[model samples]
Target: MRAFLRVAAPLLVLSAPAFGQGGPSPALIGRGRILATAADCVACHTVEGQPAFAGGKAIATPFGTIHAPNITPDRETGIGAWSDAEFLRALHDGVGRAGEQLYPAFPYVQYTRLSDADVLAIKAYLFSLPPVRRTAPANDMLFPFGYRPLLRVWKWINFTPGRFAPEPGRGGEYNRGRYLAEALGHCNECHTPRTLTQGLDMSRNLAGGIVEGWQAFNITPDPVSGIGRWSREDIVTYLSSGRLPGRAVAGGPMGEVVGHSLRFLPREDLSAIAAYLEGQKPLRNPGDTAPRSGYGRPDPDRLSFSLGGNGLPTGRGLYVAACASCHGLDGRGTASVPGRPGFPGLVGNSALGAARADNAVLAIIHGVPARGGRGESFMPAFGAASRIGNALDDAQIALVANYVRAQFGNAAGSPVDATSVRRLRLENGGRSPLVVGVWAGMALIAGLAILFAARLVRRRARGNGAERMP
Candidate 1:
């Protein structure tokens, strides 16, 4: 470890100057690479199991799927040919490969606040990689909305990209936090709600918004619906442990962000993150107060994973022993928050109620994530905590699995037995889950073709009628 650091130190000092005056330092680039990981840049840009920067990753969205672009230095296809000025322009201004307007889906609005040096460093590190000569798939946009010019309207209403302007009186940490939240970290990308035209509704920044299918919960200081319940220490601990005392483990995209991203962030940046998160507005829930019907509360004190005649118990004994404290014997969750937009009611979570049962069990088996939209790398992974390192016996996993399902709200009558949980655990063991995208482009093309054919048929019928009349 000492030797590697020694080599890095000199390499940075020697190569950093090559960046030209105000260019970039090798050390800065190196640091940026680490920050990029902390930002989980690759999680979206590079699909799981693929080599880095060879883009083919899919992101789900309400409009359609947006694929991450190639980040390598390939001259013909990647950014190899781009100059330092062009690079800065792209990040600071949100322009595309040909200076075309880029959609907000790229999150450049968040990146606009990054320092010129930080942006250059990240670009340099990206350039240092082995170029992957792959072209990104064309964005699947709906008609009258597909062209690049449409973004002019999007920008007119939503975007205000530029370097962050921190308050002079604020401390260094607060300033740093502001920079990250506004620019590179883009906490609001997920947290802020969007309008019908798909522009960000800035009025409700950090108030929790939905993107694709997943919801990015409000990170504000609201006591009822926000992170106001968490102390600064609690936020830090969750960032480190992926588990909170009263709250659950971060899950979904948040898990990938932590395992692959936040693990590399500097301690100071992480601290800055906590500081910023601690200052958001409290959650102001608006809606129909009645809880969604059908999911009934579990009978407390009844802890059995019986499968009719069989006892295929999974994770039961473990939950009773380990999780029964704050969560209570029943998985009913808290009265006001047990089930809501962001805080999914465990008893009746759709993921838990999944017909296959694997998704729900896996969340418990792996751990729930705290991945809401505003930031990346805030969640942590706990696969080891469960001791499922191919180290624990199958029976152990099953005991806890059944325990959570039955205790939570798998069904009003049916219990998720050990056999169900064991089957799921074995099926998904050791595999990294892939993010899926909705391909609306295919549907759009099909619709166009059908329209074309209908026109042709109508023209032929009119000619035939004219000949018959003559």
Candidate 2:
């Protein structure tokens, strides 16, 4: 009996880690893969033409560029040597294997809300990937801002480390949606506006912000500026297919997001996200206003216009040359027959109707492709070095964009200048300069405080010496 007990105990000990609560079963690994997809890990980690998850993609932030590290299981170059506890700390506490503070560019602030089981599941899936030995580029940040220790201060001021707690009395769907939206999906990272300190402003959660030159439109419940008017099905369709007939089409970064992440999500998950967004507190910015109606009616005079009228650059001439064939000189889209898919209408469209002209300009600069599950209705690119249509200069793109906004969108005389177009083109799309001047100002103040403290200490030392001299 004693011999049997000893053998049985050793066997149990050997098998314990595999069957434990955080064990790496096939089901757990599969779940982790789905969660990682929802998190869009590949969008930031996988560089073009590189091995998957080798992680050399450069992510631009207001402070500077941060290169994502290899998360593969390579012992030296990846996370192969990391323990489960270490990985959890990295996700939940934003600490690295060597105890270095990870930059917020990794979105650990949002990831901190994930449960231990979720974190371990992710680790399990990552460990399953083939290890690649490629090293990532070093981060390119400005002086003092590049200091890793400075993150301690940022975390203390901005971070609240805790797993998501389901709100009492809420239905399971709502709670599940909250977990997916707030933690796994990290939707607020793009949609929410940032404070002066570069932290997300919770009061205006999902109220929208510009990310990488594309506007992440408001997803809150406000009728004017948000998706309050959209039904749950509308949200689901947009998430699943990236477009909603007459309303708006996803382009730029959002196109990538839908193509890579949301489209692959199950219908149940998409429904939950819609439910959660619908239940959010309504928030409206000061300039919120509805789209003007009756702007897309046909204009007889402009219908027969020729390209390059009077041999000078005019918005009308450009639109006639570049856009008239598809969108029609009337500004109403072609192929509007019932039961047939049609090009998006220019008038009263959310992309055009929004107070900001950025989306409209962006569509012109970087053409919207057929995405999500929506069938082909491709728009050729006109921006510089475009592969499809003739590459239009910044001025030409601006002219056409402004014309559409005024003539069709009823956003007449809205400001979208050549200079702004040039900047957006040059920057490869814009991020808010939220951290630029603020960090410099803080550094100056910190230096002054240090100098003041040193002076005070010197004065006190001199006073003590005088008192001791008798």
Candidate 3:
């Protein structure tokens, strides 16, 4: 703790310029509020019943789980006493107030590009809030992830890439819009696809990716596959209201985003986001439509459960006894979560995409939450609070895993056995919290900003040619 204080004390002295420039008045606070609207910082940083900005929210990932830390004014546990300079380091340099490296999950890569003034305005607003004395919960990670220092290595590879900004020749609104979407907002945290190393796949910028167990549909302008069908007006309506009359409704994590953050943004900002998004390169088929093996769209009433000697018997028995109550006998999932057209039938649902069974294996091993667009908050996490509590052992877990694979028709072609499940359980034992997601509503706004930019450029060139024709 003494070391931490040493790291932070120097920073406390340097940041007075940024935070104090705004006069710390209510009017300045209002300006900061406008900047805050662009960033959507509160959604991930604050939890309900908790002081605003005093983090401790949980988020899930493919590897394990992670928790956001406290950013409040508590001198001991939170950043309460942090200086403006220190706060800037945390945002732009991925360093904490105490000079320790912060995890990339905090999105410093995106924040690094923020204009100095904008960062200061945000800092002023945050400092103005009433200090909340709350400490953040610890994150639960496996071996390397548990070691926070290792994050520096991840930054070495990924963070070295660069920050987001528009080309020099771009329009002012487009550039400002880019700053709002990429820098402060860090929208890529959910929208951009990731590489196997878990780094953001910048090549596919905003093409859409899966997050929190739901398919984050592509917002690109691909006519057949993306949201190219929606007009700019259609885009603003959805982001501001969380629903369009005929297009779609928000589901999963998106509902929370619209509920908490996007709605508060200025109408102009919404339009800019919409314009920028619509202008992105259109993907041919931008969705996770791959079906799991062995099962085609199953007819609930006439579905067959024959194993054909390919599945594990032990797992089949376990499912009948344990999961059938809520998930249904044929895995049709009853009326409770009738599920989406392409997503129903766990035996064949695409999340069980590959036949390897690791994904499905883990879900049954540990309870998967609010998956496949079924937003019921009914299911409970079983990691730390299971009745049997890791009782299945390895072989049993593997058998159950294999049973699901064969039963669900996953074609990854790898066999899951009790051995695999035991290994995963042991490996994941130290991990923290499960995940959950939202109500009925559609999320987003349409912005064909890029496409419009291209058209404007073409028009300008044509006019120049006409003038030169004399």
Candidate 4:
């Protein structure tokens, strides 16, 4: 549900310094707009309060930061100058107009499956936008990754450029869903784990993955650790509205996906996506015993208070003062005023009941915004940077989160600590240790190669000296 769309619609990496030609019909442009929305192109290509598709947003990865390039149809700074063939090559071959290899951050590997007509239609839509004369900043990448030539090797082993083919026996609806999920949606890019070369790990596709410090939980149909219990309606409801009441609510990057992309999609497309996801092979995370939303109940004690203070308040006191107003003393939420959906109940909320407390902690720190089709649902921030009067420090936020989980979620084990809070605050989420280890191993190999060369030079020098002496 996260980690999508900056390099969407191919951004048509320009090869030559020439402007686009001819005018496209309104129908074609409209179709392109739908495709672009499906791809969530605006999320990555547009910065907040900036011209859409002007593209200076920074995408973070373990390797470094990649700024989404200017995709607005400005001849000098954007893709306005790209030819149709150049646009096609960029999307299908992961190559820039100048024949430079594009980083996988643009997602051409998945896009390579797009039909030629679909690719061109997106281009037509982009060309229709008013040209923004803006340029994207240079990428700030690590030593090895900055060298674009290395992408050739990465793509060779991991990429297979081709159009999607429908299954012979399956009906058109199933194939349509497959096309939307695999080609247009590219859900696996975030939900699926990655291989050593940072490519999608297809063997355990959609089992689960992490992005930007938040876990994009398993979408497979496993009874445990995945969405086995989520009916097709539940999936569609969550996708379209960003909440399933007592189940899950969208937060972090998932919230962005809902607000920017999925909400705008047609109901049928949402249903199709749900169908495709439900049909995926069930894969389980090792320790999960029940559904994430099945734990916790209404608190028995409604009226209780403690401050534990030497000028410091207890978690219960904080919750009572700030949280209990909207979410009741028993943790059942109240209705909102007019146009908005009111505060969500903490009990039976997936964020609280999940094995990892990352989402719950993040919600307390950053606050949730109005997203999906759910009304103007909103929460205020309580982190260090928050301007609100009720803002909490790392230690305080930890206390509140732990208290909520214990009292309502029944998730009784290791508690969320302040150190973990600080790390998440720094935007350093859980990256795969295995990937880090691989990089370290490569560095060790390079060092050994250098040592061997030095030893050989010394041995030859000594042999020549001995021969001269004799």
Candidate 5:
């Protein structure tokens, strides 16, 4: 009877209803929707022109490409077949259905901190989406790393499974902010630098790291290299709209984050994030002694023009012709007219002031699209396919970018070259040499273990033979 009950118990649990068995309550589904938005699941899961959550987006990592799986409710290709236990396991343990270990690229490390209730809520929300029958492309990872079983070792070393608990004596706002920033938002995944093993270096949390070829600027409270100088209002404004005049504008991944995710967040939630960020310890990059400064004024002599024999416009001439109309010859932006806000000032702009010139080059190549609730002022792209601006080649774009940096950004001696422009234009993904080294080290350890095991076996066999002879 005991044995029968045990077997029956297992069957009963399997047959039990999952989170959204007979359709979740409207309030529960709404909560789940909010959580999903906060998590920005759509950003990673959805491909352009495809049904939401019917994933085919390719997330590039230092190791390889990880194609996001369909999360739509399709029984064959999406999460429709996933049980509550299976879905929760994916969130809490980073394990997929069929007991397959999921890659960290899915950020299960952060999701692991979510409570059971939260996980179920998210699952319920996902199940509410119209199921699409689509399968994502397979991951294109390099050798050894490509082996999914290797993730077991990776998880064992880096992953710590648990739910987030609020710190004692902290205000509600602070705690809420911590949960949102660390768990729901997974801000550290990109903002914080990775260890040699590609784990988050929590010791230097939010001090800044590179992602996708663009600098994820430091958000720590350090006055020199971080956001220490930013007011809470500044942070909120930036988060709400993705722009802060005279400070910075969002681009690349950040732009997408703003346009799609952050801008939609409520004011109180934005405030919470700002509060949490402000409370963090000030961290600065190595050798960053002082705050960055903008160039006071552009020198007239520096704007001298000299055309190439090929009749291509000189850097100064190009700026004068292509840029100076809106951004005056003096490099100060023109005043707003009846409809437009005119051009943004180049001097002291964050993109121009950055240590690396990639952002500046990207802006010149791709141009700033109209974003947020901001009116229709837009910067036309100068790349090959630009409809408004001259379809300048790599050399011309580099020339204009370097000239702006030197004259308006005080980066006079350090110039961006054609080669750098070409590279940035072609390669938007950053490489991870550390990931390669980790794989190599793992191989070495495995080899040594095998050799040691063989020696032990040989010694045991010899001992057994000696015993028989004796």
Candidate 6:
């Protein structure tokens, strides 16, 4: 599961009594298809290599794994039985077929802002797909989160079921962009930091947050920390194709979003999204001195990869052995045709230039997956057993991350240690110490309460027996 989906899973769990047997119009179904794509429906609803929207992907969280439910109109196990009203309620109110509260992992909090017509159109499009009879495995949520009814309290505190309202005097482009980004794309759900309860903190919208150990860098208009310097075209190109040469390249969850959703949208709609983001409030993150991609320069003379007596590779040696081919010895990318895409360069690359070395470390561990469009791009994984070569250990990854950052990123003085790499390696699903502590405390309390109740029951039984004997 993507980091964003870690907080949100089992989204669009639509079901209810079937609507009339009459089929919807072809035009409506086509329109619904586009709307669903805009909303990135298939990404969550379908498991890879499975029937689209058949939904059996296990979404992992701190609580447990949530398997995405079938939404392929299967009469027995999917949304084929769902009425239009039921579908609308699921998206807009976070309610399931039997009036059960849907988990926040579904992002109904943002989906609620979708207009009724749009919501129905998505349902129509889903119903048009071929029905698969596979039932999703049951969710394995732990303790309190598994209790669906308790979501009532979460909704009460965080949710507001309402349709999107366009700002008065705002141009069509801005309003349309806002609607797509907020209601459909749900951008802030990942980009914005979460509250203690795991709800989106609107106050820091697009200021950037970590997802799956990768930084979902700030998209706000702040000049120092965000994309304020990026032209509207840069935004469009990056969103549509997932890379911007020397500036940025989509990785991790954001990469998935581009590959699955953004590239499919028409150029005009992408432009609208860019225009809207350009006008957002500029908020600077603490300690951000310049743009993440503003540091590092190509220097061919810096290459030095000497090995020690123990045959251990130094940081530079590891990078040279693993990365020098694609990202050149000079930290510039390998050369390609004049107008064709080439390997992404290390100098001024966002991943290497961030304050924290999490993204850099993770990229080395997981490797960048191949992305389609604008020519194929990929990196080999060195984690566990390497696909291309010997697997890099945790200490090696930390060394590489630090070396890459010092040579190509904004933070030369600050380095990521092996312990941080180990944490990201073992538990990169955003489980902070505070969250673990809270869970531990709750478990302890529950155990103590159970013990107290058992002791009380034993005492009561003994007293009753004594009274009977008398």
What is the TM-score of candidate 6? Answer: 0.86
Candidate 3 residue lDDT tens string, 190-302: 77787755688888877666665444555667654456777888888878755553244444456566766677666777776777677578765534233222243332433
* Total clashes for model 1: 31
Native-structure RMSD, model 5? 7.6
RMSD of each: 11.1, 7.3, 16.2, 6.1, 7.6, 6.7
Off by over 4 Å in 5: 1-22, 293-311, 324-329, 334-342, 372-376, 410-414, 430-470
Clashes of 3: 24
Report clash pairs, candidate 5. none
* Model 2 lDDT on a 0 to 1 scale: 0.76
Q: Against the correct fold, how does model 2 do in TM-score?
A: 0.85
TM-score of each: 0.64, 0.85, 0.59, 0.86, 0.85, 0.86
What is the total number of backbone clashes in candidate 6?
A: 2
| Tens-digit lDDT track of model 5 for 358-452 | 88788778776666565645677888575564488888888998888877774743578888887776455434465556666776676579679
* Candidate 6, pairs of clashing residues: 8-105, 9-105
Taken over the whole model, the C-alpha lDDT of each candidate is: 0.58, 0.76, 0.58, 0.79, 0.77, 0.78
Give the distance in Å from residue 390's predicted Cα in candidate 2 to where it truly belongs. 4.1
Q: Candidate 4's residue-wise lDDT over 157-242, tens digit each?
A: 89999987776776555666677778877888888888866789999899877777677888999987788998889999898878
Q: What residue runs in model 1 are displaced by over 4 Å at the alpha carbon?
A: 1-18, 21-25, 287-303, 306-470
Candidate 2, residue 421: how far the Cα is off, in Å: 0.8
Question: In lDDT terms, how accurate is model 3?
Answer: 0.58
Model 6: per-residue Cα lDDT over 295-410, one tens digit each:
98775565577586788887778888888888888888976766655788989998777778777788888877766665676877787685486788888888788877888877
Which ranking of candidates, highest lDDT first? 4, 6, 5, 2, 3, 1
Measured with C-alpha atoms, the lDDT of residue 249 in candidate 5 is 76
